[model samples]
Target chain A: MDDFVYLKNVVTLELNQEKCNGCGMCLKVCPHEVFGLKGGRAHILNRDNCMECGACSLNCPMQAIFVKSGVGCAAGILNGILNNTEPSCGCSGNQSACC
Target chain B: MTTFKNPEKAHSPYILDFVPTPAGEVPRVTGKLKLRDVLGTFMVRWSVNRDNYRVSPGLYAIGDPTDSSDVFVTANYKLSFDHLRKSIDGLNAWILVLDTSGINVWCAAGKGTFGTKELVNRIRMCRLEDVISHRRIIVPQLGAVGISAYQVRDRTTPAATATLTAGSAGSTKPLKLSFNGLKVSGGFNVVFGPVKAEDIKAFIRNNYHATREMRRVTFTFSERARLIPVDFVYGKYKLLIAFALFFVLSGLTRKGVSFQLALEEGPYAVLNILMAYVAGIVITPMALPYLPGRSFAFKGFVSGTVAFVLTLLINFPGLNFPEMFAWFLIMCSISSFTAMNFTGSSTYTSLSGVKKEMKVAIPIQLISTIAGLVFFIIGRLF
Candidate 1:
């Protein structure tokens, strides 16, 4: 079922190859298998499946993953915009850390 | 964290007796919905019933399971478990609940909580090999995001297509999965079957046959409902505070001096905040599909404009030039701000696009709100 792909360039996931120690943590932690290890480095195999959940960034010990987290939920962003605060997941469902 | 008033009472009319498995002892259900179950379902759906909804992670017997029971896997999320149990009212099946940290199957699958590794782990933990005569699992269709059927064989990176038909005799050959895109032809995905208790047998039977048509799979009602809370009841706690702030601040001077009361200039204060809410929270989102904007911030701007006209007609019949100008800035910006917030909530919104829009939109919203607040104070005083 690997041929499946969602919309592209939506997720802000970035991998710093120089900083990556090939720990393979991103591959393991990612639910959608967005990353794959090649030549002892993490490669983004699929970009579209990334839901911007930020599990990889938190799990990445070397800080190799750079994603501006907490911008995924509209309700959170709405609250942030109206209340003048940072936006994140506002709904109780579909969550892990930030919006 | 709201607890169920009665945790032990069975909600499904079926009396659950203890059924022993290698993993642990579990309650065997008769597939009846209990009164408390109905209450719990509503409470949880509305965000009142908190944590107690979760069923323990283990194998559960439905309608008196045997070694031949078809093993259906799901998350420990109460709703997911409940759906499975409630659907099998008169049938015999085994439910294996995974530890998804209290998330439903479809969502947990995307999060990788309901994954192949965990699937293998649960299989081993339950010694499922011994319990079931035939080795097969019916995974939900949406779970393909996290699980590769090829992963079950411990093979290398899967090819896009691989065929292995079971029972090669006649037209009734064993079904095999063929993934072309989002749709799987001759596959083994059981999507809630969009089915209920009465149709359990047919749903199970349908999964066993190979079909070339994409007839079975479509966006189900329950699926869409998961994303949209039609009530707009979210963020109530914050709204209450904002309402109070508007009521109090509108009656006072910028320097905290007051000879004026809220009821006197109530229309000005109440209308401004209300217009903002309608523009952002109500209009932008409710009309999201019809709105003619690609960017959420742009949509918000449109909603804000609509709010301004409505507010003008309702509250300020003879609004002066400055009053019109100030209200435009404040009220429209409020609507615009809320519409932008909807970007984060929308599934279709792209993260990169939103970040870019925020840089420009946020500054404008801030400037407009500040300018509006200042003009409003000036208008009230002078």
Candidate 2:
């Protein structure tokens, strides 16, 4: 029987294989098991599981990765849209009033 | 459809028919509740027990509210509901909740879920005109994005005042006109204040894996190596090429430059590489605040020069003209490259600023490195 995988299809992660230098750093750091090594190169086996954390891009030695990194919370996105700024979840700030 | 037994029936007796006095309001004991309890209720409202969403988005009365008690506005998200109830010190206040799809005021406002149409619809649904005689409603500042004050006034006769909106309307506006006046509005305000710093710190701590885990540190017999190549990968490769060129030039000047000679000369080669790396990676980030100049490139130059001087004092012992010139070139190159990395980290620097810095800095660094290589060849030959 094939192993079952729980996928969260909220975000997508893409890898430019031609730019990958086969540094297994992405595999070592991703909290989600999204990438698999195929023929000595890193292949993104599970794109939907990615949270768009930008970990792969930051760690890629060859500068071959990119992602739209942002919080998934609607509150933060609303603030960003209203203020014409990058959206951020208010969870990081003063907690006196925010739930 | 079955008549949804109004949850309001439980608190019906306490519901006040008029606006409460703002002063001498008894502080409610809602603040002492545990965060988990509040979050659990919110999760339930958002997920499994969905009636919290169906609670006829309108005004509510949480506790026994008197005519002279305070009135607060909020969303129906149980977490939001709990936050408002808990914040009051001892105030018997009317609670007006708008339907926001389980989202908070700031976000709901931004998405237009908490705008004039919803507020009007909710007020009408709850028969707010019969429950309270007051024409005022308080809103949070964060929700300003979603609501247009002008539009709300046009749609509903009730006056809407934001907690933080700049107004000289005196106290006569039907709404007491402060974000803090309403429990839900105040929640939005508090989240954007001092609590923001703690949130940022937590975010940084949690995301360290994203920031630092990409790079690895390797240790060699003579030196430590950082395996995580910096953003500008080409710079490191170029430094290696420059060193190779220096060695080739050294060989051309002499009959044969053996591996032993290269090893004996390893310190200089390493020093050049170390300077570039330090300026690019370590010094650029760590010394960002103390760098003498504002321009990131200039700061890198200063750091590179310092590193160069320190290396000369340790390695050359007695600095001659050739060594001093070569050292100068090496420092300049290392600093320029490191300074270029600033564009990646800063919030203020623009893309054009980075382009300009690179256009000027890269050529200077390259020319200096080449000049230093020429000097090294001349010194070895003569």
Candidate 3:
């Protein structure tokens, strides 16, 4: 995962240090080690590695983390454009297998 | 061929038996995978009956379990359920399954089918408090995106606060917990488990601690390779249309649309289309990391360029300059577009990154394809 990183400075992930209660929930739930504990608060260690999954923001008790997360699939985007809706991997109401 | 002892659910080959519980009869499952399960997995990998592949959503018993046995939560997708059951084989536990419309945990979670609402609903519907003594449920880490731990905790009222029935002094009546638009009964602690089900044993053995490695998601060669069959099959109809269009287009000549010329050159055009398909759908994914650029389209272009040159070398005597150049544009665009689509399958790509890539890549591909077709017609007709 260290060797494989996506585009840099593109993720929407932002942390509000003032609002953070040093709960460490972000560090515990992130699939990628995007969050690290620094001085008893959650810090974005690897911003580029963040896939915008929104796990950290959802679990954060103090609402310190904010990220506009959605399916990153190009097909999902194209689907959204075609259907005039938010991007989805055709996971809803479609029988086709999706990633 | 069948291991299940339940005569009522005779169609279900996987269920071992149904054990009567306080709420209802829960299906008992085994950890050992049968040949049928393996074949089903193979079919699923190939995406055959993929949409219909699912297990019934409800509570299941893995082994003989007491009231305090650890409860593991999972999706209704048979693959996810199977993996979870197999991972914790031989362990006595209760499995609370939520309906995810046959999708695996990570994908289903991302779509919100495996979210907090469904979890709360399932917990209430299954009367989990009447079966399990402990108030903790282990959920996979990948599913954390949709499941808000705090929301689940806050939504479910603690079992201690549940009202005791007046008529039931020592009666076996389950707790009468009602759910409105907001709250439900028997709040459970959401313990985020490892990303993969295989690590459940180690995770439980180590006192529910997941090492950093267990949380990280990886796209190894095998993992990437498994996704190929579905994607490869995806281009079949498009490839057939391309083949037909190119074959008819090959008949265009200076004098008129010539059928003899089509017979001579049509197969070559089809071969080129096949080359581009292999380059984009197969070669690009295989050589993803080794390919020169981070952009999937760039990698596909590189692979297509190589395939284009290879096609040139293979058909040198028959091909003229205009047709060769036409194919060069067509092959590169096709490969590039196909590779760009791979962003969907890739684990590391972000929505913002993909949006950025597509904005630049789509116009280029569209222009290249149109220009290539024009050049091809010019080469044939003029």
Whose lDDT is greatest here?
3
Winner by DockQ: 3
Q: What is the C-alpha lDDT profile of model 1 across B1-382, one tens digit per residue?
A: 1112345633434446767655456567656777777787777655564444676576667877776667777787777777777776677888777777676664565557777677666766666655655455665544443454535434221233233344553444334443332322332222222212234455566774322222122223343344334224444555577667666656765567453666566556676777776677667766765666666677878888888887788777655666678788877787787677655545434455666577778899899988987777676555
TM-scores across all candidates?
0.65, 0.35, 0.91
* Order of candidate numbers by DockQ, starting with the best: 3, 1, 2
lDDT of 1 at B33: 74
Task: Place model 1 in a CAPRI quality band.
Answer: incorrect
True interface contacts reproduced, per candidate: 0.17, 0.00, 0.70
> How close is candidate 1 at the interface, in terms of C-alpha RMSD after superposing the true interface residues?
8.5
- Rank by lDDT, highest first: 3, 1, 2
Q: B1-382 in candidate 2: lDDT tens per residue? A: 1012574533332232323233222222233456565556544433334323333344544456654333555665555555665654245555667777666554455456666577667656655545444445544433333444434554554334333343464444333333334322211111111111112223224542222222211122121112123223424565677677555543433666766666566557566657766775567646655666545667778878888777776777544577567767876676666555543323223233344455566677788878986776666655
In model 2 chain B, which range of ten residues has the least summed lDDT? B186-195
Question: Candidate 1, which segments miss by more than 4 Å at Cα?
Answer: A1-99, B1-15, B20-24, B88-90, B152-203, B208-231, B253-256, B343-345, B356-360
- Least well predicted 10-residue stretch by lDDT in candidate 3 chain B: B1-10
Q: Which candidate leads in TM-score?
A: 3
Candidate 2's C-alpha runs over 4 A off are A1-99, B1-197, B200-253, B317-320
Query: Candidate 1, B312: how far from true, in Å?
Result: 1.6
* Number of colliding residue pairs in each model: 10, 22, 0
What TM-score does each prediction get for chain A alone? Answer: 0.76, 0.79, 0.93
